[model samples]
Target chain A: MIQNLTTVWRFRHFLLALVRLDLRLRYRRSILGVGWSLLNPIAMTIVFALVFSKILGGDDLTRYVPHLLIGLAVWGFLKESATAGSRAFLQSESYIRQSPLPLGIYPLRVVLGQAIHSTIAIAVAVVVTLVYQPYQPEPTDPLAILSIVPGLILMFLVAWSAATIFAFVNVYFQDTQHLLEVAAQLLFFLTPIIYTAGKLVGKAWWWLELNPVQIILELIRTPLMKGHPPTADRLLAGLYLAVVMITLAAGTAAWLRKRVIFHL
Target chain B: MAKIALTDVSLTFTVHQRKRVTLKEYLIQTVVHRRSISTAVSVHALAGVNLSLRDGDRLGVIGHNGAGKSTLLKLLAGIYPPTVGTREVEGKICSLFDISLGFEPEATGWDNISYRAFLQGESPASLRGKMDGIAAFTELGSFLDVPVRHYSAGMMMRLAFSIATAIEPEVLLIDEVLAVGDMAFQEKAQARMKEMMGSARIMVLVAHDLKTIRKMCNRAIWMQQGRVMGAGPTDEVVDAYIASVTRTAAA
Candidate 1:
């Protein structure tokens, strides 16, 4: 596994080139360019804040806006990585056939692209939180900024692992992407994205901690929405999940590395 | 020093005959029909082949269709892992296989050049020195600024051939004769290929044209159905291969 990672690192320039090519091709054609990527989450945040604020009771832009924006951004990266990464190998079939590029770089290329788009959305969320405080909430805590660095690192790891697994799995079964789409939709509702986790307090509240994505989301969302860093339990839980996912990703790569070219 | 040693190496390819059935179709087919259809076709592309090459050896591979000539070149290039046995190769391997197929249509000719060079293991720092030479070889001129999607098939072939041949490899693997682009460009490409082969420490080429193989290679192997049927001095192997063909024809 370490050797596999070294191989990928050796081809880091090629991986970066692939990511650059994807980003360039994506934005070069449209006049709106990156504004299009920003538009979807921004528009979705506004719509969700308006509708969900009523359901959760009262006009709480401070709480709802940041929660909705950050939640949507995180979910967007996670979902896009899996969906797009499902075909990452197939997409690079030409390169795969020609040279011995580490297959992991294909999903890394996709995950990096989605992460960039999501990071932009997260930046928007942070900006809105600072600029649009509806309550007497002074979240000028520098620790919130420091805390997010770790959270972003953890988020990237999870996204990379998921994308790697999906890329390999989809090579064997084309239905993996379709199934992931359905699972994403189901998980979107199951995980409290638009809805608040505080609402589920006192009944099955442990479920939130049990779900590491929810924990990672809280690690990301707490400072923006609640003006404080996430609790220690949430940080540990997120770390544990990241490690688990990375191990799974490593295992998948080891098992599928030699055989995937045949499948392709 | 460039060296390649294969000890009873074999490669098997499992090709999926059809798209794998989803869970729904699979259940209906297995549970309801009480029989499952085999979906994979296993091809023994290479079987227990052993060979060695030292520095300055130019080996040519000749084979009929489905006889694994391209597969052997790819195997040497490390594109496909041997299913069994051991392959010990010490060198930087540069391969020219399907070189024209991997370019990004949305990218400009210059962008394609860099990326293709990158794929061939050329760092940007190294590519800087070779960039002008590659571009000049293409003769695309102002077309390098334009997206490759706009270029003609012949133009794309020129760009691909130019970028692919830019590298100075320790071990070179060529799949078939790369006679690409228009007649003028083809001659230039042929000359460049000859130059690349001459400069490389060791080279393995796969080609159907026996005359070209005999001219270019010092040693040769004749492959048929994934095994080496004949191997030796180029002249002897070519004579044996030709004799086999003619004898079969007479029979």
Candidate 2:
């Protein structure tokens, strides 16, 4: 694992170039360029606020808008990274066949590329927060910035782990990408992104506790929405989940590294 | 010194006859009907074979399509792990199987050069000094600023070949990609390849051009049906391979 990490670090320039190339290719023909990244979450937030605010029909509009926007932006990152990472190896078959590099770099490239897009989404969230001042209390906690540190790191690790695992399975099972798409769609609704976790009680609350996505959501959402760091228990739980996911991802990648070439 | 040794190495590829079924399809199929998915068909790409190479070895591989010449090169380059045995390689290895394999069509020639070299594990700092030389060799001139998609096939090959051959490694692996481009570029490429072959400690080339192999390689291997049919001095192997082909054609 150390050797693999070293190899990846040594080839960091290549990975960065690949990420840049992916971003350029993705938006090359579009007139708006990277404006789409910011627009996507903003558009979704407006639509969700319009529908849910009408259904719930309460004074929760100000509170819910920022919550939904942040949640959607983060979820968008997770969804794109996981889905694209799953196809990383398959998509880079040309490079893999011709050049010899550590296989881990491909998935990392996907994750990092999506991370950049997600950073843009986060920037949009910040702008929305500043412009609309949606938080009822207007979170003044100076530590809120510090709280986001762990959440961001944990989010990247989880996304990277998921992507590596997906990329590995995708080589042998071509349907993994489609499977991930369906799974991500289901997971979006299941997680407490649109609705606050505080609203759930008893059985519903138990479901949220069991859901890793909800835990991750809380890890990030608590800092931004509630003006507080996540509870110690919640932080520990998120860390443990991240660790387990990374371990499993690394184990599977090591076992499948050479074998993936055959499938490719 | 560079060295490569294979001990009874073998590779098998399992190709699925049917497309992979999604979870949705699988669940629906299981519920609606009682049918299982099709199994994959395994192809023995390379049978058990043992070979060894040391410094200053120029090994030429000649075989018909699907006869495992490329597979052998891939194995040596560490692209595919042996399914059965073991392979030990020492040195920095550079494999140029598909010259244009990693080029982004929408990226400019200069960007593609950096991208391709980076993929080969060259850092931007290390490659900066070599950039001008590679650019000049490609002869793309102002075309370097244009996207590779706009370049002609020959121009693309020139750019790919230039970037691929820019750096020298301890061991070099080449497939038949050198067969492209104009006659002038081919001669220039051949000279560049000869220089690379001389500088590299170990070189393995897979090509169909018998004359080139006989002239360039010290030793050669002829493969038939995933097994080495003959291995010996380059001249003898080329003569025997040509004779077998001509005799089969006559028959």
Which has the greatest TM-score? Answer: 1
DockQ of each: 0.62, 0.54
Residue A22 lDDT in candidate 1: 90
Worst lDDT run of 10 residues, candidate 1 chain B, spans B19-28
Q: What's the TM for chain B in candidate 1? A: 0.94
Across A159-256, the per-residue lDDT of candidate 2 in tens digits comes to 99999999988876678898898888899988888877766767787788778787787888777776667889999988998999999998998888
lDDT of 1 by residue, A1-264 (tens): 777789888777788887888998888879989887889999998788777676656447776787788788888988898899888998998888888877888899999999887778888887886676532356657556557767888988998999999998888777888999999998898787878786666876778868656867888877666566777877888899999999999889888788988887
Runs of candidate 1 with Cα error greater than 4 angstroms are A54-59, A132-140, A201-203, B27-34
What is the Å distance of residue B237 in model 1 from its true position?
2.0
Each prediction's TM-score versus the true structure: 0.95, 0.91
- As for model 1, its CA RMSD to the true structure in angstroms is 2.1
Residue-wise C-alpha lDDT for candidate 2, range B1-251, written one tens digit per residue = 88999898889988877655565566677677877664678989999878899999999999899999988988888777789999999998888776767678888999999988887778889899999999999888999999988998899889988988898889999887466588988999988988998899998989888887888899999998889899889999888999999999999
* C-alpha lDDT score of every prediction, in listed order: 0.85, 0.84
lDDT of 1 by residue, B117-211 (tens): 88877888988999999999999999999989999989988999898888888898898887688899999999999999999999999888898
Chain A vs. true chain A, TM-score per model, equals 0.93, 0.93
